[model samples]
Target chain A: MNESNSPRLDRQDLGKIALVSLRAARMIMESGGRAQVIAKSAQTVACGLGAEFLGLRIGYASLAISLGDDANMITRMVVVGRHGVNHRLDQAVRRVVQRITTERMTPGEVEVELDRIAQTTPKHPPLFVAAATGLACAGFGRLLGVDWLAFVPILLASTLGQHARHYLLGKQMNPCVAAAMVAFGCALISSQGAKLAGSDTVNLAMIASCLLLVPGVPATNAQTDIMDGHPTMGSARAVSVLMIMIFATAGIWLAGAILGVHP
Target chain B: MIEAVEHLAHQAFFGGVAAAGFGILFNFGTRDLLWCFAAGAIALGLRTLGLDAGWSLEAASFVAAACLSVCVAGFLHPRLDPAPDMIALTGCIPMVPGAFLAQAILGLFALTSPNPDKEITTVVLSVEYLLRVAFTICAIGTGLAVPLHILKLMNFRGSAAE
Candidate 1:
């Protein structure tokens, strides 16, 4: 519909639109959308729902949005839940945004869509994830100079570490602490296995096995956000990556000391 | 020549495996995982070729990632629904300096021990490894970002004209 044929939405209607838009924005942000994408999506959704303006502020931990002109605007802020990658949710939100832009979606419908997206669960089971982690770290070990003899140790160590991490995270453990523990356990196990195999690449095995603990998503996202002009969010992600690295290193060091394998 | 090709092929295969694994961890679906595998394989293959040509590690990584990003944006983005960044960035995982970062952190931790005189070499090695990690990461980031920036600009222009 063109401008004249567009129905005039009152402040209340705009408020609902704003809430739904904010919900979409929060979902995208929490699901690892970059700041620019989040802002653009919120604006697109709000405008599609008949709001003239959307004032969006995206932070690492929260999102705030305003609807309507100066005096008549309704603003809302929501603290985002745990930030992590959820590709299905990301794709779902993108679909909702696309729908809103192309087809006329009521605020209620948008909310329902957002709710479904929010309820999205992990795509792969824990066992599958663990198996993938094993294969991945083994590949990484080969790339990092681990000999074929040490590959089995890296695979088993990473698989067990991933399981340990999955269990700890399910128990509502702090992600950093869980990562540290997993790293320590994987390093200890891999080092011992390497020794048993008489492989000289024990240190390489230890390093490659715990690589599943590296914060690859956040580290990459940090750089993207920083380079894309979202300094605040970028810095937050960068700091989190640094902390994980430190904690994982501490775990590796402790394991090495116990195993008498100093690299 | 055949032995060299075999070596590169082996690395590429492992790179794809690693990328697929990371794709699952990052919550990607099956199709996206396949794309990740391809991206990883291409990236590692290119980097391996570069290294064989005597390029520095950081330079080779930057070039490989940049080539991957450009290919993603120029050829793949329109056909694919998922963001190009996801595929390209995940592909870069096989190149991460996890070992260097770990060694650097370990060296720093070792410096706090009672042997000040023994720590000079450790400090130097730590600094070296830390610098390598930082430079490598920066190279990867820049390589990824440059193409994305160009793509975004093209998109902006296209949208503005509409």
Candidate 2:
């Protein structure tokens, strides 16, 4: 029975509930959820489990949560992992939160569900993602005035770059390093390869091929977070975006210099 | 006029493709991807129309983002909608001005090169492009933030009433 209806929860019970809510919050944060969203989710899970009060605090790398009803309360903090965009996982977490509030899921059951959501694979395979990214960069190239004949290089380069990024990330390479390497390779291919193919849009192809590495979402999210009153987390995201962009730009500059291409 | 319409349509279609592709890359599901595609098309189409009407890029992008945010808030079921911000952000991906950012970066690199004869034109162009990027991003953020805040306030009121 929930504490709201049953006897007072013991410290152990409060600890368990607190941990469960903390896990939920961590999952959302790791999935690139906004600070407000993460706090709301944690609070929802805690309250639905019969906690009368929840004190949730979110940071860039960790989250702490306290759950209590009356004299008994427990606080727990765990360092979350790297943040990345995973809309499916985020949506799954939302559904779980909904179920917890509406269906009265037990803390144990919610933990199991969170684990399942954590392990949920990407909706599309790597190759398909690569192809889509390739097509996307080519589309961007065309919009930027790349000729049809020159579009192939951007497509091929971005596809290969995305594949390489996926592979390197799978192997646990640093994202900055992976992005830099992929950008370098993509620029090299698009610039030199376009020339070889007799395409006149080498510069555009070179610029477009590396577009997949841009941290557009995170950059945008940073400003939104700051506006929404999460200055610390927003600044953290902004710094990360700047780091990735700097490294990727360095890679592109190096590749262009080697190929006698000026941006 | 017909040629202009065709150009706008073509650009809008590619914008949708760009958004859908990014949606996939971000792991949105099939249904959400369709929404993303539509949102992207709407955003880019509106921006193109604004541009044709003599709006600056920053103003056009701001209008597009605000309109898209409102559409998501107004049309989608609050409980059923996947993150509205995600849809808006992904749709605005096409308007990110990647080329301009790259150009700014390149200009900065040029200034760093050990050439004493580096022209004032390099400094001026770099600053101009950097400012453009900053203002455009700021516009998109403000555009998204205002409507989303309204949505949040509405939801809060609804919950309070209950």
Candidate 3:
């Protein structure tokens, strides 16, 4: 849309547009979208709002973007909270930008639409997530050449750990703390598999059960961000992932120390 | 030869199932989950095949990750563009070095023992395990990024930098 021909949205409208767009970009970043995609979506909104200049600075846990015209400039900073990779939400935000440009929706309409997207509920409940955790780890155990005997323990321990983690997260517990606690429980349960008289590698079951807690997305994005010239943000995320790994292992070690399981 | 393919298929299926778990946790839609599963299965199966063919662990891991990035960016990106990274990121979850990480920490517990012999064994073993963990983690990062870097070089903005 031509700037001269476009319907003139008020300053208030532009402000609302910027805020909504910032929230959307923050949502994307916190949901595991990389720096490139985050910039693309935010730029879409800024330009859509008829901004003549866009300046974006992405950080470890926050992002700042300034959108301005010849006379008016609005810069907004968004704090990126805990990341939970939800592709569906990320797609919703992207689709919103596409809709704004194609439909020329007013900022009010855009805000309402974003609010609707935010209100959309998760399709899977916590119970389903817990069960999927068990299933995922069982699949891991199988790939590791764990037989059915050991697989049973992996499945059970993972399910138990997933439930505990789910409950803790629901209570707004720190993720690393939840991870450590869940790993302890998982290891304790899996140690029973070690006691079972079998030739199976019992340690495999214990380790596999904790696979669900590994921060795979963070690790991947950290590398991408660093390679893409966002070293500070990327390394921060990398350190976070490394810390989560250590916390998870510490939990397992604590379990072993208490349970007396050699493996 | 047929047996190898069949075994590969089986391994991939497990990898898919494992990746699907992450798909679930990540709140990927059902369609995205299926695609993520396939990409993960293929990448992991390829890595295992390379291992069976006598490739080094790091080499196999890096190759698998590169394949995963390619599959996600090239094949899945167009279909799932706006959110391309989601599929590959979750798919690689199963391949993270969970076992080696745990062993590295477990090995650290050996530090408390008073016996000098036990401490020496612990130090050597822990170092070896931590080194492997470091390599595997590096393998995952480099593996996944290299393909994306190539695409960026080619100016293919399907998923990233578009």
Candidate 1, residue A188: how far the Cα is off, in Å: 1.1
- Fraction of the true interface contacts (Cα pairs closer than 8 Å across chains) found in each model: 0.77, 0.67, 0.78
| CA lDDT of each prediction against the hidden true structure | 0.84, 0.82, 0.76
The TM-score obtained for chain B by all candidates, in the order given, is 0.89, 0.89, 0.85
- DockQ of candidate 2 is 0.61
Residues B1-162, model 2: lDDT tens digits: 999999899889988998998888888888888888888898889899999999999999999999988887666636326466688778888888877777788888888888824669998998998889878888887777788777662222223124
Residue pairs in collision within model 2: none
Interface Cα RMSD of candidate 2:
2.2
Q: How is the predicted docking of candidate 3 categorized under the CAPRI scheme? A: medium
Candidate 1 ranges with C-alpha deviation above 4 Å:
A1-11, A120-122, B153-162
lDDT of 2 at B151: 69
Candidate 3 residue-wise lDDT at A158: 90
Q: If chain B of candidate 2 is superposed on the true chain B, what is its TM-score?
A: 0.89
Candidate 3: tens digits of C-alpha lDDT, residues B68-146: 8887777767786555556666767777767776777777766766754577788888888888877877788888777
lDDT of 1 by residue, A191-240 (tens): 99988998989998999998998877777778878877788888999898
**Model 1 Cα lDDT, one tens digit per residue, B4-85:** 9999999899999999998898888887899999999998999999999999989999999899889887678754554667
CAPRI quality level assigned to candidate 2 from its DockQ score: medium
What ranges in model 2 sit over 4 Å off? Answer: A1-6, A52-54, A120-122, B78-80, B116-119, B153-162
Q: RMSD of model 1, in Å? A: 2.5
Q: Which rank order by lDDT, best down to worst?
A: 1, 2, 3
